[model samples]
Target: MQFRNELDFAQDLDQNDPLRVYREQFHFPKVGGKQVIYFTGNSLGLQPKISKDYVDEIMKDWRELAVEGHFYAEKPWWDYHERLAAPLAKVVGAKTSEVSVMNTLTVNLHLLMVSFYRPDNKRFKILCEEKAFPSDQYMLKSQLRHHGLDPEHALIEVRKREGEHFWRTQDVIDKILEAGDELALVLIGGVNYYNGQVFDMEAITKAGKSVGAAVGWDLAHAVGNISLSLHDWGADFAAWCSYKYMNSGPGNASGIFVHEDHLGKKDIQRFEGWWGTEKASRFMMKPEFEPISNADAWQISNPPVLALAPYLASLKLFEEVGMPALIEKRKKIVAYLEFILGEVAETVSGSFEVITPEERGCQLSVLLHGQGRPLFDYLMKNGVIVDWREPNVIRLAPAPFYCSYEDMYQFGQILKEGILKLSTVDSLG
Candidate 1:
């Protein structure tokens, strides 16, 4: 698929896009009365236009039905979380019974760790990627401390070779088996937040289990952006936030996947709550905690209908377009972005290297060597909404749902202008 530097070429692609109509479903941010080219779906997705209506429906239910909305509202607030199960299951590639929407991502991560990260003396180490998102790092550290173990001694990180931004797949597998009996759990991001490298979860899971350890992933950036097969991959459990690629608004509820193999295990320890109890005896108020038969057992609280509303709004788009179609669009647009980045390098003084790998979904993490915030500021002032990472990376994700090929082309033009300005500024100073 040869790509051209022409904006018209990009427009032609968008004109033929089957999912082009979905761009209208979202409301883009505006600056100076013009729409901003938002490429930050990897950080925070743009809001869907219909999300308001979905949330309003829940508000109306609460206003009219009051307590009875628990059972009588359109979705029945008591089991409202159930609404997203099947759709989210499709997004993450799991059985309906294997998926549940409940707590926020890190909270769910901790809850899952309670069941999966059982570190015995023989297997007391937890292996994860180096420089994971801070929340995951903190969680792992605190979890180790809670068990009276030291993080420095109990945590192992898979490292990239010198002079590399991304990890090699074989290196990760080697680390998993290298730890062997000493590794109790393997927890990594399904798609890396910094480099946008999609890990080979199936191979990692197989390696971890072969060495007698539980395996899980934080799918925050992978859920809607990639085709997942968590059930087939044999991951013990996984969790993800819906706000990024899922576009469920800021800090919406998260989705969880507990493999069917672990669903019926009564001996697994968890923080029990009323929502986790069997529906048959939920209102009975039994002193005993009889957990639900499947992944719903991980639910420590009932779902928040208002917050969960936007999930319904966003996932409907996913159902309509399907991941396969969305993935194809993602590839085309990202290729266009990659092509444009190359064109910019011919004119810009400083080097800009892409850290994201070919296995990545939509994001391209750009390393702006010798140029910093000035370039990012220029892009922002010009209504280009990309995210900046510490030290020097800028993340640009052309989301399949709302972002178009024209947006990618325009972003390249804006970025080239920014680079030219920054190069001149640095030279003058």
Candidate 2:
């Protein structure tokens, strides 16, 4: 697509967008009586306008039904979590039973590791991307420490070559093989948070499987942003938070995807709870755990109905629009965003470059070589909402569900102006 630099082109695209109405479903943050141009959906998505209604429904059930709400409410609390299975399954591309809403991301990661990350004298190392989300970094380190292994000795990070912003698939495959006898597990971000690069998860899983290593992904950035088929790709297990592209809410419940092949295996250990017990036996008061033969087997507690309500509200939208349609819209928006950024780069004398590759989702991590906080602050003050990573990168993710092509064009204009203003300020200083 030859993207035009004119505002009319963006406006036309917005008018033609099939999903343009989706923007109205969300509550955009207002600054000075106008909605800010939001591009941080990769960090925290905007609140769905229907979120309050969903939460209120749960609250009403609690008020009137009390304990009876567990079984008697309109959407019974007893089965509140089960309702999420089909929608979450569609989002992650798995059999309904293979997916479940559970604890937050890191907690689920640790739970999954209990079964997948079994280190031995021959296989004791974990391979993950360099500079993974800090929570993942700390989680892996702590997991290794819990097993009496040194982080330096047991963790293998696949790094881009010097000067590169992202890792190549072959490089990761090479590292997986290089670790060979010492590799017990391979975990990577499905879409890296810093560079916005979507890894070749299918190929990465295959390579890890070839080396007798279990493969998993932290899909915090990938879920609901790009197409996924964790079950088909043969990912051993995966976890993701719903607050970002999923747009559930801040710090909402995360999801788990455990491939069916991994389920029904008695050897796989998980921290146990009543929530995972088979429904028929759950209320029997029997002692021995009869686990559900699916991802719910990993649940440590009954579903948090309140926390799950907001995500359930958003998942209804996911079920309606589906990932295929969302992904199609994403491709167009990303192309327009790339084109706008390219145009901005050409007009600016300041050092500006986009580090995200074409194999990315909504995010474009711009490298502000000589200009950083000053430029970012200017954009924010001017009603542009994006995020800044330390050292010199700014991440702008125009989410397809709510972000319009006009938003990209306007953000580009803001970038163009911000750079020029900062360059002048620096010259005067």
Candidate 3:
């Protein structure tokens, strides 16, 4: 497709976009009485207009049924989360039995590690990417500490080669082989939050398991953004926050995937809780814990209906549009965004380096070489919503669900103007 840096071209693309209708479903924040061109869906998704309706339904059930809402409400609080398992499974490419909605991302990761990250005298080290999301970094360190191990010794980070911006698949596989018998687990962000690179999960999982290590993914930036096949890839476990591309609101309920091999097993080591027990026998008051026959066995508490409401609502959108359609739009839209960025770079004196590789989802992390925070501030003030990282990188995630082609074109124009203006100011000074 020939790309053009014109309003008419962008509008023509948007007009023909099959997924364009989805943009109207979300409520965008207005700046200066105009809707902002949002590119931060990689950070926090815009709230779905239907999310309120779902929340209201749960609220009405609570108000009218009171305590009886647990079993008697329309979406019985006892199993409200079960409704999410099927759709969430489709989004992450797993069986319904392998997926469950539960606590937040890092919390679920800690719990999953209890079962997957068993260290021994021969195998005690864990492998992950260097400069992982800060929460993941802290979680890995604390987990190592809890097991009486020093992070400096037990944590193996697969770093980018010398001045590179991305991790090569072979580099990670080679690292896994080097760790060999010493590697206990391999946990990494499926889609890196910094460079927006999608790791080769299938190959990495194979490599980790070959070395007698467990494999899991932090899919915070991956889920609802890229294609996944956790079950087919033979991943032991995975977890993700839904507030990003999933649009489940801020810090909402997380979804987890425990492989079918791990499910229905009483011998597996996991923290026990009343909610994790069998549904029929939960209220029987029996002392013995009978784990659920699925991923719900990892759940430690009853469903948070209020939180799950938005999630379920969001899943409805996924079910309607499907991941295949979403991915189709994602590829085209991201390519268009890349094209626009290239066009802008050509027109501006400032150097723009897109560190995000071709194996990416919706995000394009731009390294602004001759720009800084003031340029970012200029963008924000101009009603272009994007995410800024340390040093001088801005993350622009044109989420296919809500971001339009015109938004990409407009962002290019705004970005070009900001760079030129900043360059002018520097010259004058």
Candidate 4:
């Protein structure tokens, strides 16, 4: 489809968009007393208006029912997190029994490692992408250290080609094979945060498993933003936070997926707690720790219904639109955004190079050569909300759910103005 930089063209696209109604569902931030064009859904999603109703229901239940709310309130607090299992499973392409909501992302990853990352003398090294999200790097390093292994020898990072912006799938597969008997685990962010590149998880998982290694994904940016088939991919485990594309409030609960093969295994090691015991026997005060028959076995505490409320509210939107429809709009809208960027670059004095590869989801990481923080400040002052990385890069994520084609066009205009104005100031000085 041919995309034009004209406002009418963008508006016409929005007019026919099936998901356009969703834009009204969110509350956007105001700058200079007007709504800013939001482009940071990769970092934090806009809050859903209905999220308040979900939170208020929980609050009202507490006010009216008190302790009895655990079992008697509408949507009982005892099993409120269970309500999310089916819908959340559908979003990530896993069986309902394989998915559960629990602690934050890093916490869940640490817990999952207890079950999946068992290193021994023969196979002790872990393979991960170079410059992983800092939390993940710390988690992996600390876990290795706890096992009495040196990070320099136990961690194998698959570095990108010297001049490239993304990792090649074959390079990751080759590293897994090269590690061979020494490889104990393969964990990586499904979508790279810095470059916005979507790794080929299926191929990499297959390669990892073939090498006798446990495979998992940190889907912080991938979940709700890209299509995933964790169960079919044979991933041992996966975890993601809900605050990004999932649109739960800041630092909310996380979702986990564990393969069916490992669900009821008695030999599997985990950091068990009361909530992980069988539901019927939980109140019986039994002495033995009989694990739940599914992914909920990973839970270390009672589900936080208050934090899960907004997440369930957001999942309702995913259930209504479905991923296929969302992906369809995502492809067209992102293509249009790329076209607008190219058009703007041709007109502006500054060079804008998009580092995000074709295998991306919503984000486009732009390398703004000869531009700096002043240009970013100019965009923020003028009502364009985007993410600025260190040095000279801006990350723009046009989420298919709430972001519109007009927002893309408007961002292009704002970005062009910033580049030209900054260039002029530099020249005059």
How accurate locally, in lDDT, is each candidate? 0.90, 0.91, 0.94, 0.93
- Model 3, 22-104: lDDT tens per residue? 99999999999999999999999999999999999989998999999999988899999999999998889899999998999
- In model 3, what is the error at residue 268, expressed in angstroms? 1.3
Winner by lDDT between candidate 4 and candidate 3: 3
Q: Model 2 clash pairs? A: none
The TM-score values for the models, in the order shown, are 0.98, 0.98, 0.99, 0.99
lDDT for 165 (candidate 3) = 96
Q: Which ten residues in a row have the lowest lDDT in candidate 3?
A: 344-353
- Per-model clash counts, in order, read 0, 0, 0, 0
Q: Can you write out model 2's per-residue Cα lDDT over 203-237, one digit (the tens) per residue? A: 99999999899999999999999989999999999
**What residue runs in model 1 are displaced by over 4 Å at the alpha carbon?**
none
Regions of candidate 2 where Cα sits further than 4 Å from its true position: none
Least well predicted 10-residue stretch by lDDT in candidate 4: 345-354
Collision pairs in model 4: none
Spell out the clash pairs found in candidate 3.
Answer: none
Worst 10 contiguous positions by lDDT, candidate 1: 344-353
How high a TM-score does candidate 3 get? Answer: 0.99
Ranked by lDDT from best down, the candidates are: 3, 4, 2, 1
* Root-mean-square deviation of every model: 1.0, 1.0, 0.8, 0.8
Model 3 gets an lDDT of: 0.94
